[model samples]
Target: MNETTLTAGKPGQSEAKNNKMGRLAAASSIGTTLEWYDFTVYNLMAALVFNHIFFPSFSPLVGTILAFSTYAVGYISRPFGGVIFGHLGDKLGRRWVLIATLMLMGVVTAAMGLLPTYFQWGILSPVALVTLRFLQGAAIGGEWAGSVLLTMEHGRQDQRGRNASFTQIGPSFGTLLGAGFIALITYVLTAEQFMDWGWRIPFFSSVLLVVLGLWLRKGVDETPVFKALETSENKADLPLKEVMVAHWPRLLISGSVRIGSDIMYAILMVFTLTYVTTILGLPRSEALTATMLGAAVHVFAVPFFGSLSDKIGRRVVYAMGALGSIIWVFVFFFLLHTLNPIYICFAVVVGMVFQAMMYGPQASFITEQFPTRVRYAGSSLAYTLGGIIGGGFSPLIMTFLLKEYNQSLPISIFASIGLTVTLLALFSAKETANKPLAE
Candidate 1:
């Protein structure tokens, strides 16, 4: 791996490297596909259905908030999974831990689909939902790091950004698959039918995805980097302990780097569904269609941006994304306010495009902040910490603000704070796009 090989992000890679990466990418994609599928569906259910099924006794607005609180619980639980599984990933290897995380998410998500509503279960219904959501969050927390590392570590040094993009596609494909499935169900089922049993079908379908993921990942091996670490006497040296004691400040900065993107995603993908329906009095299907199309375009855009990061720089692409979002969010709301379907679609598509710029290079950028020894723990901890403040609670906070003020201004203000934090992180952080990973 000399300069030429490292810089040959083009088609000059050996046949062996390409074939190996293709297999790893395929395996990693399926598992992460399941992760985001659950993510999109669960959040949609929390916003649209859970309020009705699990908290029918409360006011509609109050129930939405409570349902979102349950959604928040998952985020709150992510750090635990990050710490527990991150340590395991570094201690053991990235491959098996991912399998475990995949299975955990599958079982827990299916359980949510099987759960009875409040009328049938009394106080147990909502409680059970929260618990399941927590486990789902934990699974995702661990899955992200392993997937990113598996691809990044296995691929050529120059191609890390593109390789990591495969992992990033999880959300794109998962959101598409999940949203498409939900949309089909909603289109065919009557409100009564959807409320009764249709919602459960998606949850139960997780088993099939988990099975597929297991088969694909079964043949995948541990990353060469981790295998090398295993041969070393230190073997990363208590990854979690090393990360926290020596790299606490990095955690804060890396975590805050996510504040903007998370806030943007929460608004465009999550909160917009609620906002369009409840605030603007738009049809539920309209909002869904907008986001579905937005996510669809992202499938291509994400990879392109990832490749672009290799050419220009990771920090440049990353900061540009945050800046674009800060400017575009206001436009997103304005378009939605028009109540024109075409503009609505445009707004959301552009919104997702901004996300593509950020998310495309995200895995490599963040993971590069840590050395090989502490990467799993440091990266995972930073990721979950960002989740807690950014994606985890942004929707809930925005919803409360909307209810309190009857305006979108507060929402924009809050999102700006998240993006601002990201810019600050980029300013303080070193550019790692052209650099080799620290040993």
Candidate 2:
């Protein structure tokens, strides 16, 4: 089936295709949105709430280290999520796997809201928090590749970049919602009330979003590409095994490609929240507002770059973003260092735009690298593993660096090093646009 994102034609055919693709895109987006929202929300809570609530016995610095350490543990579990859900995705279907992940995240995130603090549950509290984060990470592990493929496979070959990018909107939306929701909660409540109950509101609200996601996904058919793969009876019973054994090189490239974007996102979106508040002595609202504004532009930037990739090729756009960010990281810090809100917002928005360039095309880029038989497993593993390498521990690393060196330059330099690796991977990756979707 040939489908266009924009089509004005016979109501019965062209319009139907467009509607179908639109619905699929909408449904796919919720998973990614939830994934990133959860990731972002947890980052905020770790920096602001968990370090104090869950690890009250430790020094503030050590407590934050512990909070973020739990955050990193969540990333460590993504591969398990990838392996489990990816096997089911490749063997069973994308639609159900997505629904399953949504269900899992909704439950876990809400559970996080109900968790007892250290003052209440002692060691059991943090233990439970870690367990929930682990489970939450696992749910997100399957979301990225599955969501990207959800729309990409249903659209026209030539427009795969734009189609895949439709789902990429999740991260920015997630960041926006997470930051916006937390910002609102913080604004309304006194700091004491916020620490006690306000943070739980956002986590509880995730239940509603998950319900909406499930409703949107209901009755949605599996992607035509996956359906065809199923009919061919070419399914890999253990898709993760096949991917690891047969496509490790592609896996390396795909995973490395994610490192820069993941790290950049963690920096621009997540770490800055910590930096601005703890280091600069700004109000939490200031940092939240900066990150939120940056994510707002990122929402538009993603599709723009995704479409650009179709014209200029993925490598050019992806590498451009990677290279641009390497240089921009320093400028980003300089702007932040000035202690000007206007400068801070400007730095974050530009930094996010550069990240968007790579992220916009990433879904199509990585998914196109592997055959449909193991596409879910291959793409999920790459994404989750890269998050582990870059996004997972970055906040912890940046926090540690600041404590050790009392400077932001090392943080910028460290971020640049990861983007440099991303550029290398972008060069090594085959240009996948205007090519057949691997079967």
Prediction RMSDs, each to the true structure: 2.1, 2.1
lDDT of 1 at 379: 91
- How good is model 2 by TM-score? 0.97
Give the Cα-based TM-score of candidate 1 against the true structure. 0.96
Q: Write model 1 residue lDDT over 378-413, tens digit each, in one string.
A: 899898889889999988999999889989988988
Q: Estimate each model's TM-score.
A: 0.96, 0.97
lDDT of each: 0.87, 0.88
Give candidate 1 regions above 4 Å deviation. Answer: 1-13
Clashing pairs in 2: none
lDDT (tens digit, per residue) of candidate 2 on 1-439: 3222233457569778878888988898888888778878898999999999999998877788899999998899999898888888998889889999999999999999999899999999999999999999899887777888888877777888999998899989998999999998888899999998888988888887898899988858898878777777878877888898999999999999999998999899878988888888988888998999999999999999999999989999999999999999899989998999999999999999999999999989998889888999999999889889898989889889988999989999999999999988988878998777665
Model 2, backbone clash pairs (residues 3+ apart or across chains), number? 0
